[model samples]
Target: MLRVTDQTMTLAAQRALGARQARLAAAQATASSGTRITRPSDDPVGTGEALRVRARLAAGAQYQRNIDDGTAWLNTLDSALGSATGLLRQVRDAAIQGGNGSLNQDGRNALATQIDSLRRDLLATANTQYMGRSVFAGTSDAASAFTDGTPPTFNGTQGGTVQRRIGPDQTVRVDADGGAAFGTGPGSVFAVLDSIAADLRSGADPTSRLTALDAGMSAVAAARSDVGGRLSELARAGQATADAATSLEARRSGIEDMDLGKAVLDLQLQQTAYQAALAVTAKVLQPSLTDFLR
Candidate 1:
């Protein structure tokens, strides 16, 4: 048999009121925070999913940064190669003029001087830098890819590559092969230009030099082609990363963001329920002789 008393009723009402207050507080927190989850305990599985999404977002941000840097490096390299090719074309023109047998000594000397000037310009292009790092240096920390001399020597590394990780499983080479583009040692294009200029000054035909100049131009064109391909690849990767970021952001929002209309309605409902509980408690826990005696 169970007996109902004032003391038991008071205790029961206190517990009921505490429970209502807790529900009200939870609703207020959800409304104020504007999130579906005010605490991890509210939805442990959802918290884990949100955390995983955020981690992926952080990694994607880093990948985006890598893509930007790699693009800059490749663009600079492409521009340098383009300039090198144009200079080679101009030198080829001057070589053709110097090879004209009917042209006199003075004309050859003038053409030789122009070729020499073009050689210096080509050298400068080979040593192109971006953010103080040589694009053709091949991972070498040297200030320039080639040193200035009668036959400029390749100061950059051979076979070494500079690369950037654009994704967890993807990497792109950013630096160029300086030695391949511009032949190293005496076989270099700089030396070839010097030979042409020397032959021009001595009244010898430089038509033979044109073949080697064409080879140099071909090498630069090949390097540029490779760069263009990678740039295109990076462009695709960047777009994909951006799209993934958008989708992931939406997913994260769905997991963490509250629906304002629904949240407000829930909060209002909790407030009304708590008020009703308070009124019911007040009515049931009426002051009695026992409370007065105590």
Candidate 2:
């Protein structure tokens, strides 16, 4: 009976040691990884939640990048439009000077040259390139937005719009068609400029050309207003995107990022428990309880 009791006691001690070792390994792993849920088996529900938040965080980051790229494109376009506006004003001034009847033929010709140069400058602005892509062109990056020098042409296929993700399942188109921004109908701004140049060459009255120049200026102003409206829209959407990204990051932090305070406390608790377990184990594995009792 004494031998049987000793064997039973030894078996119980071994089982207790095995359980303590398993717990110690688990605690060490948790501390080393700094995560309670290293795998699905560790904490299935927590891991699932983390995976979902991680996916959203990834998507939000991509959307932020898209918003940045879209805004950059719009900024380049705004700069080009500003330059074009200045060129138009120069053309208008030259046209006014040409209309002065007091000026001699040589003076009129000089004004005509200025107008032509200004027209070319305007064309260059329209064809402004950003990152090897024409800012005014809808989508085709390889070709210039305007083809004809005397008169501009939209080399792009049709009205194109660029989409930017501003929020969850929300996207906004942030560009206007080149045709609408410039002109399209017969006797359009380009046609009028072409006529102005022809009349100056033929030594005809500059009055009609001057009137057309004023009208073209008005058209340009209208287009600029349109662009300004779109820019405002993009500005609003960009702000919303930024706000959403901030919110998502906050959510991800709440879901995944470890709390240093909680982690530190947990680690200390695990260490204390492990130390206690080791002390008890040493006592149980000792040669004989009588040796200590004595």
Candidate 3:
């Protein structure tokens, strides 16, 4: 036969009541918040995975922003190049007109002045700035890229490229060295323009010097093409990074978020079981003194 004591019965009833209250509170919290896991310990592995995915998404978003900033900087330089190319063409035309014997000394002088003005414009273009920093200054953003004194100095450092990470393990370099775009030594755009200006002032034959001007023109066009290609590459990389970030965010949501429907159902079942346990425990705890004495 099984034996029961008053002390044991009271303890059992108290445990059952405490369990029922805990279940009720859990059910209320789930119903109000619609979440199964409120803390890290609720699902440690899932939470960790979610955090990792979120971090990747944030990194990708920042990479896209970097690409935008880089593109804007490059576009500013490209616009200046366009203006320089147009001025060079004008100077070439003036030189051709001045070369003709039909034009007098005064006309030649006027052409020389125009060439000087165009040279100044080209120099201005080379010194173009973006947000107080010279775009063509290479790694020297604080100094002027071009100075008009003497042989015309480029006060910046050597050509440098910048890289941005746009994916989990992928990075893209989106900058071109100023020297690569503008050339070095005698083949540089500035050097050619200087030669043309000097020749125009000294009464050189425009028809003979026309070949040099054409080469300079080609170099400018090539630089423009190079910038365009880089722009396209940046655009493609930015789009890919954005897509990747979106995918990661969705994956994170799946891992971190709770299924409201399933959580609610489970809470309801737990509440019912807890209430039944409380009722049975209360009945078992109620005992008569006469029954105990017998």
TM-scores for every predicted model: 0.92, 0.84, 0.79
- Let me know the TM-score candidate 1 reaches against the reference structure: 0.92
Alpha-carbon shift of residue 205 in model 1 (angstroms)? 1.1
Q: Residues 43-71, candidate 2, lDDT per residue (tens digit)?
A: 67777877887787687677777777777
Displacement of the residue 245 alpha carbon in candidate 2, Å: 2.7
Q: Is candidate 1 or candidate 2 better by TM-score?
A: 1
lDDT by residue for model 1 over 166-283, one digit each (tens)? Answer: 9899999999999999988888999889999999999988989988889988999999999999999999999999999999999999999999999999999999989998998996
lDDT winner between candidates 1 and 3? 1
Q: How close is candidate 2 to the true structure, as a TM-score?
A: 0.84
Task: Write the residue-wise lDDT of candidate 3 on 1-294 in tens digits.
Answer: 889877888888788778877877877776778655567887898878777887888788788888888788768867977887798788778867877777776777777777777778877787888778777766675566767754567666774655556555766554445555555567666666666566666777656667767877777778778778877877888888878877897787677656788778878888888878878776667667875676
Task: Name the top TM-score candidate.
Answer: 1
Give me the displacement of residue 175 in model 2, in angstroms.
3.5
Off by over 4 Å in 1: 284-294
How much lDDT does candidate 1 score?
0.92
Stretches of candidate 2 exceeding 4 Å from the true structure: 1-11, 21-34, 288-294
